[model samples]
Target: MTHDLVIRGGTIVDGTGAAPYDGDVAIDGTEIVAVGNVSSNGKREIDATGHIVTPGFIDGHTHLDAQIAWDPMVTPSTQHGVTTVLLGNCGVTFAPCKPEHREKLAGMMETVEDIPKHAIMSGLSWDWDQYGDYLDYIEKSKPAVNVVGLVGHCAIRYYVMGDRAVDELASDEEIEQMAQLVDNAVKAGAIGFSTSRVEGHRIPDGRPVPGTFSSEEELCRFAEIVRDNGGGLMQTVL
Candidate 1:
């Protein structure tokens, strides 16, 4: 059978963090059909001699949540060969937000990530109000690279507890509610929960983020939820 594409004579740096080797890789449609001495008649061929062929890299940290709505390639990261990115760090995210909270979230991102609020405001589409809905919205987008996201504690807190999440400690009842929200997000495909307490992140109103004042008990409870879920990573800036 004829292959759809063939990469001939390349140094394949298979991303095992190991050394490189010379080989040929073959592709059938979107999947890599074969590797090593791939003898195939192909419609397209790449002369990859002296070039490196490896699995795409992932950016562990990036604030491309808003930018991905407008620019899916993520610019410099893509240029540098990052094919995947994880967003929603330092306790900020655009997901699980109401339309009325667009500016509020944008301001938080701008202040925490140094991205301009106008840039976020001009670029993003605030059309989703739940974590799952937000993921669906972005999935429909034409992304040049794959994107995975975390549910930010600040956003979840804001969505659940509203304005009170910032100034007040979460009551026992509120903490349980927040835990449920996080649980829902994880089941819906959020990678995990992220929160910030670095004293550096402040909202436009000059207030620390909601999770900044979150007690150790609150954060530990969220972490427990993540651990129980079988797949979640907590990112805290403290």
Candidate 2:
């Protein structure tokens, strides 16, 4: 049977963190059907003689959450051969935010991540208010690379506790509410939870990010949500 594409005569670096090998790659539709001496017929072929072919790299730390809405391909990262990217790092994200809190989130991102507030404000569509809706927006956005998200602690706190999240510890009731929000985000396809306890992360108003003030109990409660989910991980900067 004829294949969709064939990449012939190249050094294949099979992403096992091992050494490279000389070979050819065969592709059918979206999958790499073969990676060795591929002698199959194909509709199209790329002459990769003397070139190197490797599985696409993944960027584990990316802040394109806001940028993705406007630049789905994620530009420079994709241009540099990163075919997958993980976003929502340093406890910043745009989901789980109310309309009134949009600027707050933008300001936090600007101050902490050094992403310009005007860029986020002008670029993001801001049509979604829930974590699940944010995922849906990303799916419909059709980014060139695969994108995975982590539920941001700051976003969760801001969503459930509003302004009080910045400097105060959650009460029993608030902790439970925050836990539920994180659980929901994990179930909705977040790969994990992220937070920043670093003193440098603050809002433009000079208040530390809500996650920075979160008690250990609050953090552990959210971590439990990820642990129970069976495949999530925790990423934080303390």
Candidate 3:
């Protein structure tokens, strides 16, 4: 039977901890119909001899939250066959932001990450102010890769404590508010939460990112939030 396409004569690494083998892959539209000695003729074909064919890669940690606004294809990683990326790593994300606070968050991302502050400020649509809305906006952008987001500590801390997030440990009241943010984010399809404790990841004014100075109690509160929300990942940069 005819198929949509076929890749013939390649070494296949199926990614199930299995050994590689030479094979032909039959395809129907976007779905792989068959593997191994696929005898079906295709409407199109490629001679893949000497090439390696494998399932696309997943990049587990990325900061593509800002970059996705301007570049939906999410290049470089896509060029390297990465089909999915986890964003909002290292506790720096742009959501849960107040309109007046956009510049500060962009500047902080620039200092901690190498992205240009101007680019982040100008390139994004700034359409969302909370974690759920942020995800919804990126969805409207029609990204080329699957995106899994982590709600970040910086945004939650800044949202709850404002500028004091950089230097002050959260008060009991502030921690409670931050807890609600995590719950909101996780319920909105955030796959996890991210935070940082390293001395180096600071904002523009020489202060470490918002979560950097948090007390153990505050950090644990956020973790417990993720845990109680049916349990998810805790990605930390130490």
Candidate 4:
């Protein structure tokens, strides 16, 4: 039977630690129907000779949050064959924020990642306030590749403590609130929580990012939330 499409004459490295082999890949509609020297003719054919085909790569850590706002194609990453990316690394994301504090997150990202503030401001609509809402926005943006996000502790701290987050330790009540927010974000769509402890991760104003000063107890409390929520990843840039 004929296939919808065929990629002919390529070295296939399936990424399963298997050895590479010269083969043809046949596709029917969107699914790969066969591989390895398929003899079937196809409606469309690509001469993949002299090329190696492999699975798309995944980037474990990325600061694509601000960049994704402007570039949904998630360029450079996509150009390099990275089809999946994790965003909101190093505790800088724009979600679970008050309308008044939108710029705060932007400034932190701008400072820590060197992303232009104006690009973030003009890129996309800041129409989300909850972590889930931001994920929904990502879905609607129709990025070229899959994206999983981590709820950033910097934005969460700023959301919970306002200006006090920069220098003040979280009170017990505040910690509980932040933990609950993390739980909410995880349930909403976040794959995990992220924070930064490195001195270099400063906000636009020269102060360390919020959560940088958090005590170990505070961090454990947040970790406990991830544990209690069944299971979710925790990312840090220390």
Q: Which candidate number would show the highest lDDT if scored against the true structure?
A: 3
Per-candidate TM vs. native?
A: 0.93, 0.96, 0.96, 0.94
Q: Candidates sorted by lDDT, descending order?
A: 3, 2, 4, 1
Clashes of each: 0, 0, 0, 0
- In candidate 4, how many Å is residue 16 off? 1.2
Better of 1 and 3 by lDDT: 3
Write the residue-wise lDDT of candidate 2 on 1-238 in tens digits: 7789999889999988888888888898899999989878779999998998999999999899988888888899988889999989989989888998999999899899899999998887788877988999888889999999998989999988888989888998999998898888889899999999898888998878987977889988988889999968799888
lDDT of 3 by residue, 121-234 (tens): 999888787899999999998999999999989998888888898998788998999999999999998988999998899998897889887888988888898889889889
Candidate 3 clash total?
0
- Candidate 4 structure quality by residue, lDDT tens digits, 47-161: 9999997778999999888677668899899999899999989889998889888888888888998888788877859998899999998888789998999999988898899
Give the backbone clash total of model 4: 0
* Off by more than 4 A, model 1: none
After best superposition, candidate 4 residue 12: deviation in angstroms?
Answer: 1.3
Indicate the TM-score of model 1: 0.93
Worst 10 residues of 3 by lDDT: 205-214
What Cα-based lDDT does every candidate model obtain? 0.86, 0.89, 0.90, 0.88
Sequence-dependent TM-score of model 3:
0.96
What lDDT is obtained when candidate 2 is compared to the true structure?
0.89
Report the error of model 3 at residue 27, Å. 2.5
> C-alpha displacement of 130 in model 2, angstroms?
1.2
